[model samples]
Target: MQRIGWTRPTAKTMRDMLHIGAPIFAELFLVSLFVMVDTALLKPCGTTAIAAVGLTAEPINVLEFLFFAVQTAVIARMARASAKNDRNAIHAIIRGYLKLTLASAALLAVLTGVFAVPFLTLFGGTADTLPIAVPYFQISLLAFVCRRMYGAMATILKGLDKPQWSFLLNLIANGINIVGDIVLINGYGPFPKLGALGAAVATVSGCAVGLVCAVVVMRDQLRAREIRIPLSDWLRSTWRETRAICTEALPMAGEKVMIRLGIFLSITRIAALGTTAFAAYRILISLQNFAYLGAEAVATTALIFLSKAYANHDRKAAQDAFSAAMVYGLAFSSLCAVLFFAVPGFLMSCYSDDPQVLSEGVRVLRIIFLYQPFQAVALIYASGMRSCRRAGIPSIITTVGIVLVRPSLVYLLAGPLGVCGAWIAIMTDEIVRCVLLFALRGKMWRQFTDAPTPSPAVV
Candidate 1:
């Protein structure tokens, strides 16, 4: 009887996971904090403003998926290149994706801005919310290119095992956003109060600064010598790299679209429950983002390690890395669960003082906490599989849970259980995905460890 691969995480493995994961956790925490602060700043404007901003959340995430998909491909390729110490490949991947990110973001931003109202309405925006949401969304779209570029650079840094640089970049950007929200939203000093619109402006400003800083830092870090090439050859190489990125990115983008569609439907159902219910849902989601911060960090860290391990074909090291990531992710999720259970009221109060919102939020938040550990398991294992370049099964599993099962549960349950029912559906979806991913992980371990060294082309 052999022990499982994850049962044997070495001390150095644990140390490495922490070193990489801590900054990512901090970066995510800061980003979530800025969101909560932005929500709080809008409170004085009224619940409609909060709900209006929340209406744009899923849509914005849907837009971001394009950038994230490209970033994922960049990370995967860059990680492999890093493992092989192929500096030119790393530089080439960075250059190709930066161009793709900018062009795509610019075009998407224009289209989304042009059809802002229809887009918002499609995502469950009520008449009252649309007037506010439309302009806020359009203004926020100004940040899209900047956000995409910054994200591209950050992913590159992380893939190269330089997460601290990414952390610093986020810290500066989020700090600016926090201060800008305070000044612009409330009319501080020379700035006029613009309410929800102010939040959008602050976001644009922060992303712009982050993008500039990222470009400068990336240039300094790479320091690759310029190799003169024929113009035609350069264009050909760029196209080839871009095509490779799109090849890996398409499945990931499809997965994201399905997941966002499910969320869009769920939010629409919650919005149909009326403004107060929707506002409460928004606040709870923000708090839920906190719970996910560490899990995402662990998953990302595992992805980087696993990518390198796959390149090296070191099964034991890959196993140890996965083990450490799960341990850390579960531990952090348990801590968040305890907090959610212990002080649900206090957490909800930070965003809203309305009795109806607080009562509903506290109830659903308690239910939400129950799924954290399971959710952590699903995220980490799915990411582990993705690093193995076995993303198709995990993507299929996620699509089924999010696209089909979760939304169906929401539709069936929301009528009987109210907003709480929707959350219960979410929890059930996480549990289902967790169980499936666990089984898939076992199968992956058997195949991966038993197999001979894989070809570089496959890896």
Candidate 2:
């Protein structure tokens, strides 16, 4: 029987994952979709707006990557304690995570606030983009503190097997942001137009609502679970773990930077074909998130299950979880790929009315669909490594493949095939990562399990 903090998910576990995961997938996908919407709506305003928002994205992603790294570690530790039936440990981790997240968020917020413009310039901004990016960047970073807080809280609930609440809160928030998009961007009865600034404001407001809802929903978990965190003990352990998290997380951050830059360069190439191509690519990217969520969900679910198994010293259980999760991920991606082919223009039309944007988006998105299954494989195993607390290696390997191999090929190919060439470059990177990571997955699991650790004391 399941007790306070203990859980031994059976075959039914995967089914639970599906129910809880669907909302999470929706929320995550919509967050990206909102970004696409932000860009698409501003398209009439022009490329300055697109580049303005785009310039700020890499920096925002950097902040999120840091938050996610800590959150990932939190989930792993929380899952370990839960597997060993330690409710007290849940409280302790939450307390520690709360303090750490707040402190980190504040520091980063100050740094980003002070250096927002310079950072945007570093990502390749010009004077025309700066004015638009300035307001967008400033206001968006204001929400990162709340965002990081939500990250820790969401990880706590998800690791404890109450992921549905976390997902629901995010969806609710995104829903608010979507409505705000139309109202604020175009101006409602009394509301004045804010354009890109409106999008940023909408995002911050939505996040505020979501953060409060998530905390409220998980109030029982917070209060009912008794916690006694000793500051001295926390200082010692948190310091060590914090350092270790960075060693692991920095590469993950770097990998994201690689992706952001590669896309940036790809945009530079696509922009040559004019705003229609650039705008088209952005829309297609937003649509791809719907297909991409399966892989993201697999990665997240795999990490939780693997961390639990590794903590319990159950090598066989870990293998079972990984294989079962991965097969489902593959099936999910395959289905999405089929939809992409069968319904080409449907996704493109959501973003724009321009015939060129629609046509180019259809052509490019169809080819990208061919690579979706491969992207799923890469996400599953790379995240499997994260579950084992060995994310660095895979991050490095994929980063090299993406930032170096992929973009270099795109540069070579784009001249001949334009944006289509850029898409091929991305496809090649996903395929390579899929093959390499899958090949190494078994060996890596074996190596990690060879020295499995027992669950530690909870409180």
**Which candidate tops TM-score?**
1
Write down the TM-score for model 2: 0.84
For candidate 2, write residues 245-310 as lDDT tens digits: 456567676767777676666667667766666777667766777777768887777777777887
**Candidate 1: global Cα-lDDT?**
0.82
TM-score of each: 0.88, 0.84
Please, what is the whole-model Cα lDDT of each candidate in the order they appear? 0.82, 0.74
Candidate 2 displacement at residue 149 in angstroms: 1.4
How many steric overlaps are in each model, in order? 0, 0
Clashes of 1: 0
Q: For model 1, how does the per-residue alpha-carbon lDDT over 1-459 read when each residue is reduced to its tens digit?
A: 233466758999999989988998888887777776777788888999999998998789878876776776677777877887766676567667877887888998899899998888988899899999999999888877788889888988888888888989988887888889888988989999988898899989999999899978776777643422234543444676788788877777888888887887787788898888888888888788877877888888988888888777777878899889988988989999999999999999987889999999999988988999999999988887777677776788889999888999999998888889999999999999999998877655654455445334311
Which candidate leads the pack in lDDT?
Answer: 1
